[model samples]
Target: MKSNNEKNPGISRRTFLYSLGALALSGCDGGISAPVTPGSRATSRVSTSGITLAHVANGAADVATSGAFAHPGLLHTQADFDRMAQKVAAQASPWYDCWNVLIANSHARLSWSPRPQVEVDRGGSGAQNYPVLYGDIAAAYASALRWKITGDTAYADKAVQIMNAWSSTLQILGGDSNVDLAAGIYGYEFANAGEIMRGYSGWAAADFAAFQTMMRDIFYPINVDFLNRHNNTDITHYWANWDLCNMASIMAIGVLCDDHTLFDQAVNYYIDGAGNGAIAQAVYYMHPGYLGQWQETGRDQGHNTLGIALGGAICEMAWNQGIDLYGYDNNRFLAGAEYVAKSNLVQADGTYLTVPYVSYTNVDVTQPGFSTASQGTIRPCWALVYNHYVNRKGLAAPWSTKFALAIQPEGGGGNYGTASGGFDQLGYGTLTCTRDAVTPATAPSGLTAFPSAGQVVLSWWGVAGGTSYNVKRASSSGGSYTTVASGIADPLTYTDNPSAGTWYYVVSAQTATGESSNSAEVVAVTALQLHTYLTFDEASGTSAADATGNGHTGTLIGGATRAAGHSRNAVSLDGSSGYVSLPGNVVADISDFTIAAWVFWNGGNAWARIFDFGAGTGRYLFLTPKSSSGLMRFAITTNGGHGERAINGNVALPTGQWAHVAVTLSGTTATLYLNGNVIGGSTDMVFAPWRVGPAAQNWIGRSQYSGDPYFHGSIDDFRIYRGAMSTDQITALVQGS
Candidate 1:
């Protein structure tokens, strides 16, 4: 963060900080990568022309609040328990043995007892009763998992009893500075145990509420304080594991207590917090072969391995609640996990293998090389992470898989040892994280088919042990299919020139054994040509050429000049006089249309049009990054602003980043989308584009209102489709098609 990103020149130090400094990851529940949600960040700066601009943030950051959280969403969710119960009941090998380990443990037995203290301290000069607290935490969590798997009231009663003892007796959790660790680590653990048992009828309503209160009152304060202040030291002084545990506690407790504020807080901190736990900071540097160097790699292997435990916990929690932090920052955590796993693994000859390393440093200290102290460290945290990427997402995780197998049939809390690190993560992956049964043998997965202006593009995650892929296509949903392409090897992708019709596609993997079954299906409809396509790739021209065969080429009017675009060259507008003028009546007659473009918002005045097509203010269809009401507005008016039909995004367009903005009109329903997620829509509209008559002043960046200011940033790949596309197609547009 202190230096420019020389590797990815697209993300300069300033631009990256501006883009992701305050943003959170946003996308569908299980997307390949987490895209951005425009945030409402405003900062003032003087422009080159001496204009003082209050630059608002655009794309490259946060999702809106979840509005709601799924119940029992923490380290484990309902689905994970269900999977465990089913596998164990069927006497499955790994899960059944894993269950045996759980039932055999003293903490999981009905004979377990609670040990609580009014003040538990971990540092010097105080009652060091924190171990007692960690012990009770283990008992409570183990009993809760047993109850979940067996549907036994006895285990639930025991879990509730342990929790009640802690909540009723614990009032003050104080220590020298290490209390933060006690608070963060046990705070998240206790909350997860409480979360698992929240649904138990044996645990009465009042007692459960008291447990919630204990987590909120007794634990949350320290967790938030540590994250916010970092023990009053340099922000980078604390290790990544410290910030991670606190983040996990905040996120888990938020879900347990049903608080979106806490949930968003943890998520925002993970993505944008100026701490060691943030993605870019946690995985500080990328090395060769997709390995990302963990921030604590130089400190010690014991602490370095703890990062995987905490990060996996955070990612799993977010994934269960319909977010994709697992793939956040293009899977930086996976890369770091691979690096850590390779560095800490044994190489069959009773010797630790050496791995690549990049010297990591911060304000507090510097480590010029990797540390060999406790080098062969192994943690039970690998299974959950390995299963997610390989079995769940069909991506390779070689070292992650190796380490998980090394620690197979993982038991929670007490199985590793008596140390605090053993209890730091909620283990038991052979039972909860194993997905070998349903792992596809023949089928490739994560199939995506995107319909573009003239063609359809297809891609998928590779099947394990597969050598090649066969791309199959059909005219209808359930084939009757034929091979469009076969024997695709590396870089698993395919493009097809289908005729003007709807097409269904799937991919099958060619394993050494044989050709496997087909993957999940995807569809594409390629009918309409790009009505008015603006490439804006003319680097030095005043004419913004139209790439569509149609002759709706645009002219760079005022002072608009060619600048760096989202994908290629773009048109840069100077906020006042700069704008693009297209031929008259560009989209004046289309009934169903889709308009999509990539925008770089420089925080201009309100009502600056990304595009406006109309003869006058009374009859126009325009999309504005920010409206007078401080929201992104897409309005179509035949009778003026007051009488216009409009759809507004939840927030204004963020400034200083490239955001994919799109609007689709299907029948009377006009929807507005940012990135890939739908932000707003209007369903009662009756007017169509033809109703606006012959639009004479079809313009980009200039609004219909004479008083409105011109757009202040850049626009690229502006396109108009003759028909409104589906959500999947809009998502494809987000992928830069």
Candidate 2:
């Protein structure tokens, strides 16, 4: 809390919105229920948004899509197939080499037969019979690939036969908790195979219907259920792979069946779901050089590598559907992939390289250090990721590039190993995902601007040759431009503290040789964003002074005391009654706004607010880490809990740790962020400060309900922006960049 004015320097205005979004919080308060102690890996699930169509659409299916979904769009699109066919037709070096490997895989042979199971079980008394499912999944995909690449009807017939056998025979996925694993992993694989072969006319219309019925009936429920409740255990009890595999399956099925609802579920989950598979949780932390430490990095390399495999498949599927999950969060996925690749790939001497790691703790395990178990476990994941970021998009991934090349002509399912892990990815990435390298930055695009109380933030897309970016400003509409800032690196975000007036902004890519053309211009209507900031650095003070010029000093109440903080002294609170009361109407008038803070909590009582502002219990806007309905929530309400509209930050707050949490409202959408990353929130929040009237009970670390517990923790570096803060600005607030 020393001074957060220096935080988020790197946040420049950029395009906005990724999935971490709002779902409705149903049911009003349950009459002051007893406070539940949320331990490690606590549940962050807000609520299920929608049930998949799998529950109802279990009959004979139609042969056509809604025309919105692309055929063969799961992991391998038609374009990818065409590319492979072309490369192999010309006897291309790597493609041909990969083709050789595919032909040699026993699962791809015409003589291969499907071992149908009435019920496929992964755990419990069934003796781990999931192998039949995985092996058949592999054969189906390989046969489909042979059909697509070689135009062989025999392979198509074989693929159809394998698919029909399973569709007609498999009834239920049975087992213990591990059934979820089988549902997710093989579900995606089977759906991918069917997606490719769906266009084959040899696959009878009724036969395809049965296959669709099987997927929707047998797989989607398990996939959606695990994602919704995580076996009704702690949200973090299951690992990232568990979530990712399910997400992958759901997405593949959505594409294969053209069910937009199912498809959106997977996409939304990947973007903002509260589970470990979400982008923010999967790549949990970012180090310097944007090296994101993957969620399972400390668990072990095998699972960590599997995380990459499934994660890459999800991203690629999204990309094939014209969604850019690969570039979300400024290539954060790339950062994670690079970190994992560098760690798992060995040097020439078979020595593992060290990478930066933060200790990871969930409900079940505490990994204080990186685990080398199964280190250097190579998978077919690297090529898809490396090609998308470095070759297709013209970004850089040094570690990923080396890893992809090392395992060039990657093999899928059957070639990696006999286990299910070997088939996690469809492999043959070089045959399907490889693309010629793109040209470097010709000019930057996607420029945007957001203005607040005293500053304007500007951001733009990255270009190939962009070693660094240069920010330009103009008093006029287009220019006579002035170079205000130069040499900004990747994830370009720039804030200019402009004098009060309309301002235009643009950016250009700078390389070793020269600067590129300026990007399209954006206009800022206001000057700055910061309205009120409290560093909470005062030594043993009863009042927290406002660092911003707009006065809104807070009065410490109920024995609120000083504690060691994120930077300096912070406001500490007792669970019984301690809080900080703020000036009336502090944020009761602002339409677009952002509230952010750094808090260290003891992980105690429920319904403890980080901040609450309202006239009374019936009408208030509050942000709490332990909402009765969720882990972290920000809500604006007029009729108490019954009429609350909130953004649920579907992520657990690390107890005994200083973490950043922020909520921003722009238009009707409110986004919640944790530790500078998007978690989840609401998109249709109607309750605003103006709607809530003048808030008289504005308090920090206290709830409006008299019976609710006060937050047991410390709060520091509180900030409020008059206008909606962009992602970069909020990130800057958290990262102090």
Candidate 3:
């Protein structure tokens, strides 16, 4: 029988060996060789307008040759493991065991299977797995990693075989519900494996070319389309994970295909994309001493940690390409990483603290430490983040370091215990991120201050090596800076009681070394005024009273009953049988006004009005559901106009989940906000102004038109201000609730 090299003619054994030798020689000081730079034959095919592919190609060469930068460089090429194996009979590190676990699994799974059919399954709680897709990617990546680490021909051949199978088969991504996720999570790993093995001497040029076509044809489009659509103009709002995964996928594929535009697209979203992907949307600023809130922190720890891991993966890949995404946005990702670590890890003693989490129905619950968040599962996620934020950047992440140390001898994630579709980013960090290093503390940067409803909010950039921050405030700029807050953790934002005069603020970094110099001063002045406020904490059978001094009291009609609301008490409305009648003239005098309410909608798949203010059609201002989609639509028929001016919310008012929905109509334009994020808006409209019907017809949860829809959700703390509330005020309200 002929050898594998003899069977392939595109690349000879001699050429491959020479390339490997050159790769080994090029890893001097962990930088790429001069020939590998832009316009070189090695990266001529890929665009390099804003990003360079040299780092990726160099990492591959290093893996192929000296294996110096081989510690999880898309593919592992470290020869130290082989050296350790030669020196000791026992495995040198715990990572070796996990690596062996993958090798053993890949060794057992020698056959490759792929399907040519397309699947577009959508609209289920869980996603549809297509042709055992992610499983196949896992196997292929494991085989590729094993091949690079161990120099095993069989593993390399198996990985190539799997790639060949998928290239020739598999038509479409599996489902609709989480297609972006499938494309992102699976596409990233798949592309990584493909990128590594494309250099194999025995892999035929035709086969490699065909696989490239497969990636472009199948995976690339799915990610691009989902990312372009953003929210797809719907109420089924895409979470941060969806956007993060797609960003990861597009970026990985872009690197694989040498497409700079694609790479830039993903990075752009990471910086400024709206709703998701952007750091602002993913992180929540909190008071002193508390870790910044992860987007999924209130949801669960499994997702929270996974998000960190995946986001860290994107940053790691970018870091290899010479982009400092890890350190971007004042090291916000580090804050999220530490938050998850501190929330989930056991303390020095046996006892651990519980992290407070807010549920979907607006209920606050404390999650037990280390075990109960995300169903008490430990996802092998600490290594990458630890390596980047602590190991590489020399930042102080005590809790993250502790958690990574605790999950020692870290293993792959599949079936490790209970988690399924578990990612396998294990062991590499333990081998790579451990180093003796120290960094001096620096002053925090970008100190900023803004006034919100009833408070002055101050935020500043986080220092790289800081564990906590100190915020000082005073009424004057030159002197008398009192220590109003100290030891503020990551996401250095603080909310203080509003005083009548201007407030001056400055923040400093606190690390193991000491407190750094103070940041530039920032100032804020109280600007927001509440016109009307209703807590809806009325007696069971009485009227809903306005907390705002301006009397806009509402009479409970049709037996609307009092119950638990957003924070305090609420009033429940029956779609057909209940509604609240407010004084008609309460909102009649204001031209630019704001209406905000905390709603727990139970009106399933129907048009239901939350607020209606006129006696006939085309004569009222109303907020209602846009049919079965469950999205809220705010309409204003200016003084019985000919056409209704309205803007529909992009986010759905999900059933059973208490959501804060607010609409601000400034001049003729209307903007809708959900949970403090801008969802949608209408630009132009012509109407007379604000007006309401006689007393009986002006209602909450009921409309005056004969066939108008009545709301079936619980309403709490309904407020109508004389002027449109500023975005900052809306944000503060959502945070306070």
Candidate 4:
């Protein structure tokens, strides 16, 4: 009976949607409309949406059976498994190897031995031999998939017999402290078997109903309560994988029962409620100058990769329901995959690159500087992450892609690592998800940067399979560099105006698959006066106090909160309405000026502002997004009024990921640089001396327009200079010089 707003902040936004279940079940005398046909697509998937058995069952019946179907349905449909089997039969490259391992291990499971009165009891310690029951569930589902693919009714009959025995005889499921774990992991697999078999015309309707009853009674409650309350722990208290598994369980049950409310609950929890369920919070941002860091970065790669796999399973279920969790939050999940893959990589020198090892309680688990460790345990976990990021998103995932390739010929879970005992059988990806062929773009080599009086020119050797190039720079060779330019196609050279300092640069190729590795390092130097800088390092409070000691502080407005930055703390602006207001006249009188900052944008159709400073009607300088394209647009009204000459970048700023943006004005010219390369500018521009209203009208994440132009993004390391910066100086600034 709790209203959505009445619940604690810990409660998620999806609560309101799911809470309408009661009203939905009881159709109003004069209702808006009947629930949209389940199998047919709805105009919109709002709270009022409803799905039927036909909708959830469509996956199992689809003529061209594919993976990533609705819940309750098997992970791979009939056609999907058939293709895998065909590949196995032909002794294909990767599929046959995985199939060989699976067939070898699953020979004994061909016969069904259903334990109807199975009671897996873990002592109070929450550890037990429940894998036996879960193992049976895995076997049943695997057998059912084989039956559908091969048209072997014996496999189908065995799968049916297994479900029938459990439904007719199983009376109770308890005795384990971690009984919820059993319900979550085992229950979903069982439900999926029932879902696939439900499509079999031979399976008695009565028996299928009985199985559905069993799932609803024995598994649904446990899984739902666990996800909602986390075993009476804090809502966000459980381990990431535990929460993910339970979410998967609920989603499966929801699909099996044709309950859109329950399905929505799982989606909402993953996206909003469970803190660890979100990609941003679940995996910590990579430190500004370091590689991307996952929440479990300090943990072992086994557990970390397991988290990605389970989470992917949940998202896959959501995807079947027409949600795109895989692409959500700027594809934040990719960072975790890359982080784990990079950590587990074997270097040419035979050493492993790893982060510090920490325990579940955040305690250091290894000696100082010896925290780096690699399990080198391979499992069938790579496909889910790989198919989504590399194949679907078209983003580079070099480490993960390589790891997925190395683990090709993947077998069942018990063959390695913590996934022993039939936990994560993954032989399907090689057959179902593997690309026919992938020719990755080669990395650009021999990058060089030269500094001139007002410009820095960067050139690199081009390679094949590349549609464009990405330019990155850092102040020091060891510092983490930010992308200065992206989508620079052809002519392999770029020019920029920057301030003075030591600068390091690199170039990378980008193709349809992903980005290539950074080319060889190159350095450049320039001379420009360093000016006001604000790192926004404080983790809490309302002030973005200036780190440059120029005393130009910013006040956080509305609900602006601190968020992860390139290297430290930055302010996050709610897309609708939140920003940081700076004092007027802070840098008002400058004739020539350069401004730069690192930004992480959450895209919207609206014009999202980065920085806005100007009079409502007169001379103004503002940076905002252009509608449709959402590319970075910098404009200045030197003569006042609505007429404005703006430089709009050809390449849209990369959302979710951080990039450096700088704009400098010297004489009558204003040039904008993304990362460090010049993207857009004009030569025939009139100079406008700086001026501002006495009121604090200038802001980050908001504009001084009639309707608020609030930015839904994060900004950090903001710097402003009294004079225009040379191209090399801008490169140095972007490189953290």
Q: Which model scores highest in TM-score? A: 2
What TM-score does each of the candidates earn? 0.58, 0.63, 0.54, 0.53
Error of 1 at 245 (Å): 0.2
**Poorly placed runs, candidate 2 (over 4 Å):** 1-67, 417-421, 443-737
Q: Of models 1 and 2, which has the larger lDDT? A: 1
Q: After superposing candidate 3, which stretches have Cα over 4 Å from the reference? A: 1-131, 150-154, 175-180, 230-236, 274-278, 284-292, 297-300, 346-375, 413-441, 445-504, 509-515, 525-737
- Candidate with top lDDT is 1
| Candidate 2 per-residue lDDT over residues 1-737, each given as its tens digit | 01101121111101111220100001001100010001011112322322222211111111111237777778888888888999999999778888887888898899988999898877676666777888888888999999999998999999999999999999999877778888888899899899999989999999999999899989999999888888676666677889899999988888877887777677667754556787766886655455678988887788888888899998888778766667664466777897899898889998988988766666666677899988988888888887887778675566888888888876776585312245667787777778778875467654545543346655555666568888888877768899999878844668788786667777888876788887766666453357678888888768899988677898889969888888978999987778999876566445567888998998886788899986556457988887665588888864346446777767777789999988888756789999988888777775556445445578999887798888999999998875677789887777781
lDDT of 3 by residue, 1-737 (tens): 01111111233322432343233222111111111110011111223322222332222111111112222344232333353334223455545544454444532255644333344333344444542665666667766666665677887898888788878866776544456666777777788778778778878999988887877778888877776675353311445677677778777777677665666566555643443454534553322233545665655566676777677777766665545566654455766776777777756675455554422111122322223545334555566676555555555566677777777535442533222335534333443333334454366654545433336556665656677888888777744788888978744578787565556777788867788888767655443335567788865656777787566688888858888888778988877778888764344334455788898888554556888875344246878755445577777652222235668787676778898889876545667888898988876533313222112256788875656567887999888754457789899989887
| Candidate lDDT (C-alpha), each | 0.74, 0.73, 0.58, 0.59
Instruction: Count residue pairs with overlapping backbones in model 4.
Output: 21
Candidate 2 global TM-score:
0.63
**Candidates ranked, most accurate by lDDT first:** 1, 2, 4, 3
Model 1, 1-737: lDDT tens digits are 00111121223322332333223221111111111222211111111221111111222334434445777778777888898899899999888988888787788989988987888887767678888998889899888988899899898999999999988999998867777777878888889899899888888899999999999998998888888877676666677888888888988888999986677677667764656787656876544344778888888898888899889988888777765677665466887898898888888898877776745555545677899977877777888888888887766566787888887777776575312246776677778788863354457654655443346656565666677889999988778899999988744678788987768888888887889888767666566546788989996878988887678899999879998888789999999899999976566435567899999999967888999987565457999999888889998864455436789899778899988899987657888999978999988655557445445678999987899988999999999886677889899778855
Candidate 4 local lDDT, 342-381, one digit each (tens):
6776677877765433222221122122224345545566
